[model samples]
Target: MAKDAVLVLGATGRIGRLLQLCPPEGLALRLQARRAQAAAGKPDAGWRLFDPLEDPAALARAATGAAAVLCLAGPVPGRGAGEMADHIRLGEAAVRAGAGAGARVLLASSAAVYGAGSGLLAEDAPLHPASAYGAAKAEMEARAAALGAELGVPVCSLRIGNTAGFDAILGGWRPGFSLDRFADGATPRRSYIGARSLAQVLGALLQRPALPPALNVAQPGTVEMAALLQAAGLPFAARPAPGTAIPEVALDVSRLQALLPVPLAPADAAQLAAEWAGLEPQLRQEQSRR
Candidate 1:
């Protein structure tokens, strides 16, 4: 199979690291990071430093000859107006760079864009982002989509769900973990995807003849925090959930499923745990090898 080259911005992030450990098959990477120092002494690592804000042309040059440009650079967690504005600036840079290369552009958005919602939220669901983070992602999606339309490039926002190892409940687990138990005696439920699955989804999207403006990337259903803990053999104490707590934010991936021949993940607890445990440690092994 012929490999398609992809230029990945924010290559040093957590999700980026996961991608490094489990890249999609038949896809070559041109990695961009914040620091040149990180790429030093690694000839085969495919690492490069290109700041779109400083020199958009450098990004364009780097993205040339790629099938797609995947910009995972995102705002900080708080996602204040200034932070979101900065993120939008980066997103705009991505659009221009991809347009310069005549390649599709994929920007990383978050499920937080749906905010505190119960049941399955589809791509067409209206934005009701609760936090500054959610609002910031919403802004990025709108701006990038609008700009992509103007630029005549295929730009899509990936409304990605929680990855198994990247979620607060899993990654934040300590010796004594405590979770909020809502009045109905349930912990927060969320959609999640595995590291390898996410890579495949992105790869598949890049190869698709047509791309949707926005897509929800996740396993088929929702998983409770407690179920995740149980699957991982981690015990947690339950405290009453505050009024601010959201019960669920499940994504409707029917669209994603229809686009691909393979089935999306089934949202089983054991499999989520296995995927996280299996994929997260490989990063260290990969680093050691590199």
Candidate 2:
């Protein structure tokens, strides 16, 4: 598959942008987006404007002759049946396209699919999605698993947790977190992973010869929320509620490590918080809002 390449299905998202900036070496890329305009200056020779529901064939073509397909595309939040419908439709289309192209597919899922509780969450954890969004992600995970096996496509489902990439579209000015409270010394324990490290994880997975149809991709450790913020130079209201974990939520990476030579090193909270402080403006505002 030397001539073939890796296709990142969500080129417009935060992770997609980082991938564009530093695509894995030796692997060419096919970046699929909603519109050509969205991809205009981003790096990649193969750019396809695809609608998750209507353009399955085009998407299939894009994946055809590729080394692997990284399904990073996800829903734009707005809630309601319409939004839900959009996410499901796109998810179905992506799975179908990748299967048709006979490409190994690595789907980006969420930790929320595990719902809430406390403890280490293993890859085999029973799902108990709490929110509509979480439910949708769980559904996508199920569908991808079944379809991948049926189509004989190697699938690696990465149920990822909080991915921190401070200066990203997903990290843009939004509500809820602040940098000041952090400045004043407010910390809450939470879990987070860096975009660069995440990218490396994806790259390693793409090069794997075989992976389970589903897996969890996460950092091995957790961090205090307040300390996390302080490291980022941001502030927000403090809370004493201890962090909770969803049992059976960890992605067993032993299989992955065996297949690829690269090591997976998680970026710690201090580093992530520092990065977050430098990049996330809305987080600063949100902290101040409190």
Candidate 3:
């Protein structure tokens, strides 16, 4: 089997690190990070200090020669960076880079793109975002999808749900997401997938035969936020948003399962949520004082 070299954006993230672990056999892996100095000396690491807002051309150059580009870069909630403008810029950069490089791009989208709608969400569900964050995600998804068709590239977007696990990437101080919002009775029910499983899905995509651009990557199970906190031994209560209702953000993974060789399983979401809960207090304090 011919191997495909993959360029991973946001190479230092939780999912990005997992991409490094079991990359397709014989395919070279290149990493692009904001902080080249931080990524220096790491094996298979290629640092590109390209800001999403400033250097689209440089990003395209970095993405050149790659068979596939896995874009894990974007504004994350509570991270103080996933704001609407920033996310849009990131999406724009990704589209430009992927198109210029002529690489099959797999963009990391979010279930939040579906917004706070009722019923289980699917890839084609109506996007009615309730928050600026969700709106940005939806906009980015649309932008990437449109660019994929316009540029004549195989661009697929994965609407990921709550991804868990991995030590460093997602463990630090970032506020505004559900986990932190519902830390002590913040939000209600939600869905989650382990980072390992999320990585497995990405690996499966890398290995699968080329197809039309479209797919959702997520676990099957949907766990409530309160139960998740309890599982993690944290205070469990209802931390409802004032004007927002938390809708079920389930990414139907059946499409990917039908196409891929291996199936993804749901790990202990509650346990994973609990673990993050344990760190919430400390993280909150660190951020408050900052």
Compared with the true structure, what per-residue lDDT tens digits does model 3 show for residues 1-290?
75676777777665665665545455667777776564655544555666655666777778888788878877656455345557666766677777788778777777777777777666677888766766777777778778777887777777777765332223432343234243345445556766545656677686554744557666666666545545644442234455455535566667766876766555465656654555446444433442
Query: By summed lDDT, which 10 consecutive residues of candidate 1 come out lowest?
Result: 281-290
lDDT minimum window of 10 residues, candidate 3: 165-174
**lDDT of candidate 3?**
0.64
Clashes of 3: 6
Per-model TM values vs. the true structure: 0.94, 0.80, 0.76
Each model's lDDT = 0.84, 0.64, 0.64
Expressed as tens digits, the lDDT of each residue in 114-213 for candidate 1 is 9876678999988999888888788888888888999998988899998887778887789889999998889988898876778778778767767799
- In the range 1-290, model 2's lDDT, one tens digit per residue, is 36448888877676776676557766777888887677555344578788766667777778788878887887754477557655555666666777777777788777777777356666676888887777887888787677767777676777776777532222542356532233334433334666666677777777776787666665656655445554655545533433342223334444444555665555477776555445446434433432
RMSD (Cα, Å) of model 1: 2.0
TM-score of 2: 0.80
- Extract clashing residue pairs from model 3: 75-82, 78-175, 182-186, 185-239, 186-239, 232-274
TM-score of candidate 1 versus the correct structure, residues matched by position:
0.94
- The prediction achieving the highest TM-score against the true structure is 1
Candidate with better lDDT, 1 vs 2? 1
